[model samples]
Target: MGSPAANQCYYPNGRSASTDFPCDPGVDDSPCCGGGLGSTCLTNKLCSGPDGNIVRGSCTSQAWSSSACPLYCLSANTGGTDLISCSNVTRSDTSYCCDHNAFCCDSGVGRFDVVPSKPQTWATWSAAASQFVVVNPLSTAAASSSPSSTLASKTSNAPFLTTTPPGNDTTSGTPQPSQPAQGLTAGAQAGIGVGAAVGALLIAAVVFLLWKMKKNKKLLEGKQRTENTWPAVYPEPPKMELVGATPLRQELDGSYVPTELPAVTDRAELYGHRV
Candidate 1:
């Protein structure tokens, strides 16, 4: 290579800075600005000049923008800084920002967790499985106060000690909302959720397809049944024809002939076939 100084001198944005004393002087330094926005801050733990000079620059904080990563880091999963990696996220101060328990995901930390608190009960149960009664802490006192009355109060001013509200277990320290779910960090959990949704969609699609197929089959069957049960149609009949003839009086000197046979007006009658 010609020189490391030549590459680091020119920034991608057309800005140039030349310094005899490189940030690491004798060491070969890589080019900056290629990483894009917030890229300059990512080079080392502490901030420095464009050419990696230690004394020539001052530290200034810049908020990471959209161009910094593929996805925006959500508020819940974010640390002091907006950026997070799969392994760990380091802050500007060099302190470790995120805990290693869950994967730092694009949206945030994915949680598929199990509740930690154990439930407490004062009720007694029989092995017979038929019955159980909540042990009333005031049952004995009630019997003594008014022997005749079975449902007597413990005393005039004492409140009955029964069930406590959900989450108000006086026995332990305020139940710490179970520290962000134990295992299968953000990445694994997100994958599982996406997979489940896709599976459900596929199942629904299959069911709809099957229903459509059955409907079409029923329609075809109904059409065939109608054709089989229909009656046959008949064609039109032939029309009747008429015939006419002159009378026999014109043939015998215009006189009415009694001996001659009358004019045969009908063909069927001449043949003696008239019905």
Candidate 2:
């Protein structure tokens, strides 16, 4: 009842391979049927269970309505390899069977038949089926060697290479050390010295001019004070007399004195009267 599809065998991890094993009718035709009229069958691909039990199994798209076909264990089917006759399961009107594939599950539990309609049974069966999905050797080798090959390719064409010390950053674009600062030139140093000497000379000239002006001002003030004072005066000394000089009091009395003819003048007057 199901639509035809490829019986590509796959592991639980989505890995698959094409096998070189022979496909015999009935014994190795389909997972459920023993080579029907239009059945799709899968060849045996080895697997290992989680508990280390080895299982030989194949997948099929025969007489099943599910999109993904079921896988059956070749070693666990007690009544020949045809699962339909061995499990005695009947198909419902929906084109699904209660016993589709006898899956190799957990180690102690061995093979289990899955029911599509029952959620609980499907969950248990899927969990057990995942453990036995084999990983291919070729794929494992490629995965292991990928990093080394990439590293080799990067180093092969490099212009140069540098080894990073332990505890240092191994990334590209490391920073370099800076150069030392340059010193001043001889010409610049000489210019600074000359400028300092010129400044000192200018300062000394200004100080000398100020000192001369102050000294001249003090001399002029002293001359002005001397001109403003009055001349000193003293009393005349006693007059000095020349040798043989007359006394001032005597000279002044001589002009006003009467003559002393005294006796002669009285006698003459008496005689004239007698004549």
Candidate 3:
């Protein structure tokens, strides 16, 4: 008998909230592949803290939109689509995704087709979804390949594929090639990258301008403070010419008119001191 804990839904070893473990959020409450009955993922939130410990909480529709849980929650329209070619879409849950009675389910990184009635178990699902391949959208090689080919190549490399064997073709008895899940196009990825870069640059520029303005304001305030703290000194007024001769001038009719000379005070006396 498999250990009941083995079937329980928890983050796989080394997997955490930081890791990408894409799943169809619609069937979170259903029993995952390899999980025994009663071992449904309903016990814990699919996305949690860094430790990946299973905690009791609702992984609600709001959680999906907010990116608190970054699973590729598909809507009801994806029901009949093949698992390999299904769209890796993140949509708000209207009648699916995180609900108990999910209409559609993709067990792992949008690769495994799971009947919502019989979803992949916790052990297999977490392990498969956690093997995330980081693809550089800006690389020329990636751009050269078709979107389907690029996606197929990445999904084919999952380490868990060996662990959880794929369903074999009944007639050929050969393992079928893993189909590629449709994701964002190279152009879309590039646009997102460019937008992010532009946003960061704008934020940095705003911060720099604010800092510069604050510095200038402080400097101006300091200058004003200095001006207020000190008093100004000016040159003394010009002195009167006390030692010069009194006026004695000739009138227009040639008569000499002498003006009485007033007593002149010494500089020291003028200044209220005896000379």
Assess each prediction's global lDDT (C-alpha) against the native: 0.30, 0.30, 0.31
Q: Write the per-residue lDDT of candidate 1 for residues 92-122, one digit (tens) a residue.
A: 1211112232433322333211111111122
Best by lDDT: 3
Give the Å shift of residue 201 in candidate 3.
Answer: 2.3
lDDT of 2 by residue, 1-275 (tens): 22223434322223342331112111222222122222222211222223332233333422222222233322222322222221212222111111223321111122232222111101011223221111222223223333322122121111111111122221123222112112233454567899999999999999999999999999999888886685556668899879776756534554676778657554444345553
Rank by TM-score (best first): 1, 3, 2
TM-score, per-candidate, Cα-based: 0.25, 0.22, 0.24
Q: Which candidate is the best by TM-score?
A: 1
The TM-score that candidate 2 achieves is 0.22
| Predicted candidate 1, C-alpha RMSD | 29.9
* Per-residue lDDT of candidate 3, residues 1-275 (tens digit): 22322223322211222212222233222112121222223111122223332222222222222222212222212111112222343121111222322222243232332111211223223334332122211133334434432222232211111111133211122234343233454456778999999999999999999999999999999999999888787779898886658877666776788998678855654457676
Model 3, position 35, has a per-residue lDDT of 19
Which ranges of candidate 3 are over 4 A from the true structure? 1-184, 229-236, 249-275
Rank by lDDT, highest first.
Answer: 3, 1, 2
